[model samples]
Target: MEKNDKFPTRKDMTYWIIILILFMVGSFTVYYGSNKDMVSHIGFGGTIVSILLAVIAIIYSFYQSSTYESTTYKLDTSAQKIEEATKQLSDVSEIKTVLESFKGEVKEINESIIDLKGISNNIGNGVNSMKESFENTKTTFFESFNPISPKHVEVDEIDFSTNYFIKMLDNGGNFPLFTLALANQAHINKISKVNLRQYNKIYMKFLMGGKQADLGKDIHEAFRNIQFGMLSAYKSSRFVDIDFVEDDFIQINDINENLSQAIVHKVESLNDEQDGDKPLYDFLLTMKNKLSWDEE
Candidate 1:
């Protein structure tokens, strides 16, 4: 049934048939002779040569059959190896494709990291700029009002210590002048126990549009006089009534309200060409919270 099988089988049959014919011819020549002695003498050499030839032919057929089988086996093995190698190459190609995809994803991740770093740097720069701006505004606010000399007072001066109120006075607008006068009157009464009722009187006077010609100078004098009086009282410990001073006009809400109004007015007066007012506003709020008005 196999293609190669047919060829080898046919060759083997041909070799066997030739050997059988030689053996039959040699046997017949010996058996059917006219004289037994003559047949033996004539056929002996020929029979021996034919028998040897038949043996050589049979051996050659077996050797050729073995060679064909070995060649066929080697061809089959080589074909199987080629098939396995092809399969391995295909698998390697698939692995290469997967590796390429992985590389692309890694590239994208690296780009994202770069973008995030850029964003972080921008945020840091913005925060630094804001901090610098705040510091500058703070310096300006404090420098605007210089402190009064210690030697310039009639009565002992109360170093309210914080210069914010004085600075507000220096900013100079009608509201600041009125607020300073109010604070001064309160400070004088606290220390002197003068019972002047100046706060009630002045509040009414201002409400009724008191004279404005010399009002500014009057408020400044009153502020200085009150500072000296409070300082004198503090040194003697004669008017050390913390409750009395704290309960008067220097309450937290009252100071905050005055400062808020002053700041609003200042910001509103600025021209369109002016810078932002947020820093100044924040400075005022910080100052308001820090106002202790206590002796320290």
Candidate 2:
């Protein structure tokens, strides 16, 4: 038979029955027995049995109290868990409501996107038409607007221009010196570099050349002369500018002239320093004299 978990088991009931029967036997012995000592012993045994019963009752009451406390704790824990679950469900419901509102806003955005896609398709078609028109005009646009494209200079034009420029530099109003005075220094430098390096080389080759001939120092001399002239012109141009600006050229010139004179005198004083060894001085002073012009 399965053991019942009910408060009193069969074994406990049997123990209680045995104890009560002993108590009854002792009571009867005390009441009716003729021997005085036997009666007194039975009386004392009954008292002890009664005390065991009282102790058992007290133990049972304590067990019941502990069981009640345990059940109450379990109930309290279940109630707290249930309250937390209810709070979580309320939060989930609030989140669902927010999501429902967001769904309507997303639907509106999707509708706007669909309309925008249609408008964009029309814009794309218009752009395609404009792209074709631009493609047709592309070559002319670059030819007009592009600054990097090389100019179309004829061979004869180059020849005539070179001769005329040299003649003007030699005889006519000194065009380059006048240009240096009028134009910005940076602009003048740019023009000089292009002409001296590229056009001058071409002009020299055209004027005198076997296919493989070297026009050695002719181009070099021209380049140096251009440099010196530019410097001299720039110096003179500064004077003209200061004069126009009502600044005394001589006052400004005096400081620069003194500085220049000091540098020259320093170099000259080195002559005295190197009096014993002229070659060392001479080596340092290579190309010290002004270079003669081609006409000279």
Candidate 3:
């Protein structure tokens, strides 16, 4: 029932000791009876018996001491092992705590990173919204000035589509006039006039809303400005001039081809004839001279 009663105790050693002494006595009786003559030598027998007892006692004492030492060594070794095991357990506990702390920190960092990513996404969305609004504003601006063109636009870079639009605008709302102006040099002097007339005609038709509703007085002002600008440009010194025999003009049906060559020749001749003291050069020289005088 009780733990101590269940198992034997050190009190059981008394019974073992009594049994060992009884066994020793029995063994001595048998040995002495078997050696009666040995026992008859009185002094020698006593001496021999005493020596044998003393040797047995010494051997037993040595055996007991060795056994006690071995037992003590086993107990000490077990205690040391237990102490080391306890220290190892404590170290394992500390390591586990540190690992748990690291895990919590990592979790928090992961959460923070997720929040940052969400904030980035929100910022991206805001930027996209702003971009959309700006695009809508641009479209609205273009639509507002649909019929009439603007004078100038400022941009960081120029692209082909924008250049084309600028060319169209410069040509007084006549897209065809821009095309005609870039034609071969022959036509630039001769047929360019006819092409320019054609460009005006096209522009007029387009202004009348291209066979749809008549734009009427709405585009009248713009048309007037375009006609004035075009006429002014046509009469200006910028337009090419040709002087050829009347017969030659009648002979060539292809005005552009011949006039292109003539224009190239005229350009080369003008370059060659150019003097440093020409009025245009003199005007530029006058500006430089004024600048120098001012500096002085």
Candidate 4:
């Protein structure tokens, strides 16, 4: 749009032209007749010209006013359109901002998904590694002490380890194995010093899985023969009932079996390639599973 001052009004020009025509009409009047009855008039051409001049001036004024009003209405309409266009632009900008924010949120979500996938892959790899390790170590684990693989007895009649072991099983005065079991650690260490390693390997293999929870007063009567050395000291010991039920020994036996199995597995794994512990490993371990002393 051009400046507001540039619009044409034509009011001043119309007024001046009307005034000029009126002056010319006044100056052209003709007078005739006696003084008392005299009248003033303009000739026909002058009268016609004057009326036509006045009509033209009025028509020009009406046309100018109409044109000016039309221009003002058009300018007002244009201004309204410009204001609407500006508002639309602002709305579009706001929409663009909202879309940009949504896009950013979507990007963040995708990144989070990517991170989760990476974590999932790492977890998968770790699980696979653990599975492979377990597979590699599976054979070293033991089953029941009944022996899955039969091993040869290493000791013949002259084997020193065997003779020494038989001596440990012997308790003084015919109560043999029972007395040796409760001997102090020092006596046991001294007696087995010559072939201690072989004896220990033998003992551990047999008793590996046969450990029992201390039932304290619970199993006293069943194995009270174990306290025979000190039984004479307690005057009431002889009078105590020695009776036992089958169930009382069941739990102790089961625990021993589980421990023995675990020990076998560990030993087998350690000596898998060496084969040093193979000879009496199974025989002693299975023999120790005989929990009932009276059954023999």
Q: Number of the top candidate by TM-score?
A: 3
lDDT, model 1, position 265: 49
Q: Please, what is the TM-score per model?
A: 0.31, 0.32, 0.32, 0.31
The whole-model lDDT of each prediction reads 0.47, 0.44, 0.46, 0.40
Worst 10 residues of 4 by lDDT: 247-256
Question: By the TM-score metric, which is better: model 3 or model 4?
Answer: 3
Tens-digit lDDT track for model 1 on 84-146? 999999999998999999899899989989987876575455435434533443343333332
Clashes of each: 2, 0, 4, 6
Ranking by lDDT: 1, 3, 2, 4
> How large an RMSD does model 4 have?
21.0
lDDT of 2 by residue, 76-130 (tens): 9999999999999999999999999999999999999998787667555544543
The whole-model C-alpha lDDT of candidate 4 against the native structure comes to 0.40
**Would you list the clashing residue pairs of candidate 4?**
171-176, 208-260, 209-256, 209-259, 209-260, 210-256
Q: Model 3 segments beyond 4 Å from truth?
A: 1-44, 133-296
lDDT of 2: 0.44
Query: Which parts of model 2 have CA positions greater than 4 angstroms off?
Result: 1-43, 125-296
TM-score of 1: 0.31
Q: Judging by lDDT against the true structure, name the best candidate.
A: 1
